[model samples]
Target: LHPAQDIPNARGTALIAKVKKPYTEDPASPVRERQSVGIYADWLPAPASFGDYDQFEGIARIPGQISWRFTMHQVQEDAPSWFGGSPWTGKFDEISSELTVNTLVEVRPFNSKTKKAGQAVLQGTLQRCRG
Candidate 1:
């Protein structure tokens, strides 16, 4: 079974506040192994507001890869004020209300030698991690 099989088409963006270092279960293995990374974020909806904040902590894993880049942008509720002389400046401030999260993930087989990807399987549950 593979990791990406069960992930339904998820849409919308979330604010990622923290990203942990990538770790693997079998660290001593010579071959490529699955690496997991922890991410803490606040998921917001289209009309993002303070009242609609949902705190979430998720783990994203990539098989056979040591490192990967994930980027997140800060979305503020208040729009920045524009000064005179700027193009189309007339107290206009509505662009900051858009919700977006652009992430591109490429998953490959654990065995790098194989050109095709293996069967995709989705596993794992969203649970609260307590101290």
Candidate 2:
């Protein structure tokens, strides 16, 4: 077995990306708009910067004999125009004014030493949202 096998098996790595939940609130909004979420994985460095709509693009890695790459993005919004003036709305407006991020995830394997000892990486860009 290689690091790739050990990382997820014996070593065991877990990652969680969290954002403030208040940014997705609106009391009278009925439409569900996109929310940007900032994703931070384990053992990886902070992203240099995100692009338009808080779109973050690059390689996210696990950093081992067999590595994986990933890309992420995020955003936030109060409520869409379509949700303007509605009775069946929740308190999504009272939510904090923060960017709601939408992160896209993708994965692929990379083999260096041998085909059997291949690695996997996740990559993608974040979608934009209005706050």
Candidate 3:
């Protein structure tokens, strides 16, 4: 989801999204089951130049931890090689600053005997490191 506003001390805003669904059941264990769910993050950086936009996105499974990182760059668009070419053709840009996210999620499985669905808890922190 979108943030209320751009984060202070951060180049731009960061967004997060999550989805949950039923996972395949284990045939070996009738009582044990898994849940299908994931959390995703998108970090957008402030514009470095006119029409210059950069962003990073990543996903991690529930009940686990993962890290996401990305670097920003500023590139110059090149002239079209042929007629009706896209404007994205350009020289590679120099790497700029980088962003990193360390996340942890804990998921409690559903209790089939009790007929209760599971729950998930998430914890994480974001850091802007040197490029």
Candidate 4:
């Protein structure tokens, strides 16, 4: 069953951290880093059934049409220093450049091994490739 079926009132994006290239001792090439992405929403209604989780799944057979997308870098654990300051350690322009929103995502629910009730998590593997 779809995650939405279990959580009708759910709303939120998935914060993903994509490691482009593994940092190794090889210094020939510049270290390739995965740029962070961010997805924004005015408000994310709490999940109906899933505790502390929101839906992030979309219909199958679509590309780049995620139900919700979020870049972990976009989410700041600490508040910005100033009103216009960057959430991350970069210039305002750099921070703004890292934001990205994907409309394709899907989530599913199943019995939680740890929790007493069922759990909701992402359905598919989300990955990013760096060239």
Give the winner by lDDT.
Answer: 4
Instruction: Report how far off residue 102 is in candidate 4 (Å).
Output: 6.8
| Rank by lDDT (best first) | 4, 3, 2, 1
- TM-score for candidate 2: 0.19
Residue lDDT tens for model 4, 30-73: 55556433332212223324553333222211254323222212
Report the lDDT tens digits of candidate 3 across residue range 47-78. Answer: 22112223222222222433322222222336
Q: Give per-model TM-scores.
A: 0.17, 0.19, 0.18, 0.25
lDDT of 4: 0.31
* Candidate 1 global TM-score: 0.17
lDDT score for residue 74 of model 4: 26
- Return the top candidate by TM-score: 4
RMSD in Å for model 4:
11.5
Q: Higher TM-score: candidate 1 or 4?
A: 4
lDDT of candidates 1 onward, in order: 0.25, 0.26, 0.26, 0.31
Please give, for residues 85-121, the per-residue lDDT of candidate 2 as tens digits.
Answer: 1111011112122322333223223232232212223
